[model samples]
Target: MKIILSNASSDPIYIQIVNQIRQSILSGELRAGDSLPSIRQLAKDLQVSVITTKRAYEELEKEKLIDSVVGKGCFVSGANKDFIREQRMTRLEEKMVEIIRESKELSMSKQDVLDYLNLLYEEEHTP
Candidate 1:
């Protein structure tokens, strides 16, 4: 597992860790039953505090994205497709709300935002 810490980022370290791990799981990089490093081990590896790593893991567990077994490490949960899709849609909506708020603050028109988003989609989707 690889995690890069950004001191200049607005997001907290725990949140960054949580987001990256969730992305990894969604991308199949960390599949179901894959054992994650122990809290202490991950903390040491990331050079972050144990509490931060613990909080990240706790959030993942709370989201039902991972499971912890007694005497065993945390493993990615085998979630149903519909559950995963719903979770992803909820997250996307939250992010979209933030973007919309930022656009309003910047006085950007709806058409301008839509155009930019379409450009971004094309750039990402194109070969």
Candidate 2:
């Protein structure tokens, strides 16, 4: 597992850690039953306080993305496709709402926004 910290980010260190680990799991970079570094080891590797890593782990556990076993450390939880899809859709909806609000404020027509979105999607999908 790899995590990079940015002092310039407004988000707290623990949140950054949590987000990166969550992304790794979602992207299949980390698989189910994969053992994560111990809290102390991760803290040392990241040069952060152990409390920060512990907090990130706790948050992951609460989200059901990871499971902690006594004396065995934490491991990635089994994937729940439906739950992951729902979570992703919810996040997309929130971002779409923000985009809609911004487009309205800029006086952009619905077709104009759709055209821009299609261009972006095609650009990303194209080689």
Clashes of each: 0, 0
lDDT tens readout by residue for model 1, 14-125: 9999989988988889989899999999999999999999999999998899998978989999987579769889989999999999999999999999999999999999
Best by lDDT: 2
- Runs in model 2 deviating more than 4 A are 95-127
Model 2, residue 75: distance off in Å is 0.3
Q: Any idea what lDDT model 2 has?
A: 0.94
Per-residue CA lDDT of candidate 2, range 101-124, in tens?
999999999999999999999999
Enumerate residue pairs that collide in model 2.
none
lDDT of 1 at 111: 98
